[model samples]
Target: MLDLLKTPVLALQDFCVLCGRALRNIVRRPHYFDDIFLQMDIIGFGSLPIVILTGFFSGAVIGLQMTRALQTYGATGQIGPIVAVTLVRELGPVLSSLLIAGRNASGMASEIGSMKVTEQIDAMRALGTDPIQKLITPRVIATTVTLPMLTIIADFVGLVGGFIVAYYLLNLTAGQYWTPAYQILEWNDIAQGLLKPFVFALVISLVGCFYGIRTTGGTQGVGRATTQAVVVASVWIFILNLFITRIFVNV
Candidate 1:
């Protein structure tokens, strides 16, 4: 019982320490602008296609389902606002973050874990390079910047997908679909939508880097870290979303 309790506490402590170090590195001098840009391109561009598809399909499905449900009450017209709000304020960020956790977080952990197992990170330290500053910082910065942009794209694409379904399947006109959707959204809603992704970006990237830098053993360790990173990040996204949503609701 003691061992079980102690293990989680120690792991939490270690994670907090890693996060502190990464945060400190962000504002320090010698910022790796080139590396940051490289990571941005890799993360943003690499993840675009999947994000688009995920958003599109999610909105499409929501439209199909919600339209039918609303029709029961003869409120089918409200589908636009419902789908828009759901996609923009919730599903957009959540789904995109999940995808990024699976794709980028796993990749980061695997890559850094491989470096650790191969002793390349040690060589970097020996060569007077700070691995956190050089390797982890850039990825963190990139993810923080990229995720919100992706979420925006996802939200827009999702709305389009919703519009497509509403127009074709439900025979709703463009004005009937878009007007309520636009009117129902306020600055607060947009802020809430954008804010979650930024927080999620930090969570996913930092967690990935944390597992990665702590990798042990050999090739097997890399695989383990990669899997753990994705699972942990994905779970955190949902947990964080709930708290963030509550905050938004209360405010």
Candidate 2:
């Protein structure tokens, strides 16, 4: 029992230490701007098509379903605001973050885990390079910067999708569909919408790096780390979303 508890406790401690170090390196000298931009291109632009596709369909589906529900009370005109609020406040960020975690988290884990198993990380240390600063910090910064931007794009695309459904199916004109959607958003909603993605970006990037750095068992370990990174990042996204929503709910 003591042994079982020890592993998780130690892993948690190591993860915390890695997070602290990586965050501290953010403002340090020898900034790897090139690597950071490469990661942003990989994580941000590479994930764009899927994010937009899913965002549109998700909002369209919600519009379809809500149209039915709202029609029960002859409130079909309210579909715009409903879809807008749901996509902006929750679905847009959550879905986009999940997609990003699945794509980039696995990539980070595999890339870094391969480096670990191949002793490349050791080689970097031998050459007087800080692996955390050179590799992990760049990823953290890229994810942090790009995730909120992606979430914003997702929210906009989703609103457009919802508008299509509303216009065609519900006979809502552009004004009817867009006006309330525009008016219903507040500073609080916008704040939380952006904030959730920022938090998720940190979790996804750090979890991937942590698992990658700790990988063992050679090739098998790299695969395991990749899988764990995606799963853990995705799980933490949901868990953190709940906590953030709870905090914002009362505010």
Candidate 3:
């Protein structure tokens, strides 16, 4: 048990060292904007549709479920606030983060792992280029910056999804649907959800790049790193969700 615990401690230390080095590289060698732009496009813009689909389903489902439950008390109007709070507090950030993880994390792992296996990373080092600074730093920075913006888009589309279900399917007017939504929707809730995605982005980029940089074997190892990146980033995202929620509620 003690030995197993120490393993995690060692991993955490390594992760910290890598993160610090990557951060410094980002600051020192700032000419790597092209890679950063590509990372942003892939991690943020590329994943928009999946996040939209997720938000739509999550919002529709919430309305459907809450309507069914609230029908017993004839308080169906509460659906608006329910959707609002869920979108701003939970569904928006969580689903957006997960979508980004699926795209950015997997890609990051594959790119770095393949580079490692192809000896391109070593080639960079031989050419007096810093791989961490050039590759990992740009990726990590781009993802962290893009994630929060993606969450904002998710929240908007999610609310629209809820509105579609509530008014169109349920035979209500826009005013009736939006009344309760605006009542409970707060800027702080939106802020809280957006904040978590940035942290989630940091976690995703770091874990994916770390596994990729450490990859061994060949194509199989790269594939394994890709899978591990998605899985680990997802698990950490959900865990972070609980912690962020706890802090939001406390504050």
The residue ranges of model 1 lying beyond 4 angstroms of the native Cα positions read none
Candidate 3 C-alpha RMSD relative to the actual structure: 1.8
Rank candidates by TM-score, best first. 2, 1, 3
Q: Candidate 2 at residue 187, lDDT?
A: 87
Whole-model lDDT values for every prediction: 0.94, 0.95, 0.87
Model 2, range 46-144, lDDT digits (tens) per residue? Answer: 999999998999999999999888999999889889998999899999999999999999999999999999999999999998999999999999999
- Work out the TM-score per prediction: 0.97, 0.99, 0.93
Residue lDDT tens for model 1, 71-179: 9999888878998899889999999999999999999999999999999999999998899999999999999999999999999899999999999988999999999
Score candidate 3 by lDDT. 0.87
lDDT minimum window of 10 residues, candidate 2: 242-251
Please report the TM-score between candidate 2 and the true structure: 0.99
Best by TM-score: 2
lDDT of 3 by residue, 161-245 (tens): 8888888777767888888788887778977878898899899999999989989999999999999989999999999889888
